[model samples]
Target: MQPASIDKQINNYLPQVTVNQKKAVLTVVKTFAEQDENEYSEEFKKELDSRYDEYINGGKLVSEQQAKKRIKKIINGKSK
Candidate 1:
């Protein structure tokens, strides 16, 4: 069956389902979504690791006061 047909069928039957059944369906959907969320590409992982290494090595480091000033300048549209 097509997705639209399945969706229409689900919508038609949802109102007839018990509250516990609805909660079960919601839990199943959240599990599927969380599985997708945990999958990431190797290249993305490498990039994240590289940024973390730079942070740990103090590369491109800025003081808290300097960071706040830069943020304020950017928010005020005065960043160069």
Candidate 2:
């Protein structure tokens, strides 16, 4: 199908929703509160540890509340 035609059909299914409902839905969609311990491979763990070190040293670590606000801003199509 043509891109424009597909976009039009998708838009039909997604009517403009209220900001509150949109925020709630986006929160549920993006938030994964649990992790599977066995799913992490050694290489993935190494990469994650490296990035964690950089984030800590760069002073870019955020609290849970700050992280939520940043995520909400992203989902709402707004800048952080």
- Among these predicted structures, which one has the highest lDDT? 1
Candidate 1 TM-score, C-alpha based:
0.57
Clashing pairs in 1: none
RMSD of model 1, in Å? 4.2
What C-alpha lDDT, on a 0 to 100 scale, does residue 66 get in candidate 1?
100
Question: What C-alpha lDDT do the candidate models reach, one value each?
Answer: 0.94, 0.76
Query: What lDDT, from 0 to 1, does candidate 2 have?
Result: 0.76
How much is 43 displaced in model 1, in angstroms? Answer: 7.0
Report lDDT (Cα) of residue 59, candidate 1. 83
lDDT of 1 by residue, 1-80 (tens): 99999999999999999999999999999999999999888899999999999999888988999999999989889644
lDDT of each residue in 1-80, candidate 2, tens digit only? 99999879856755777778777866764564334433787899999999989987885677999999988988889543
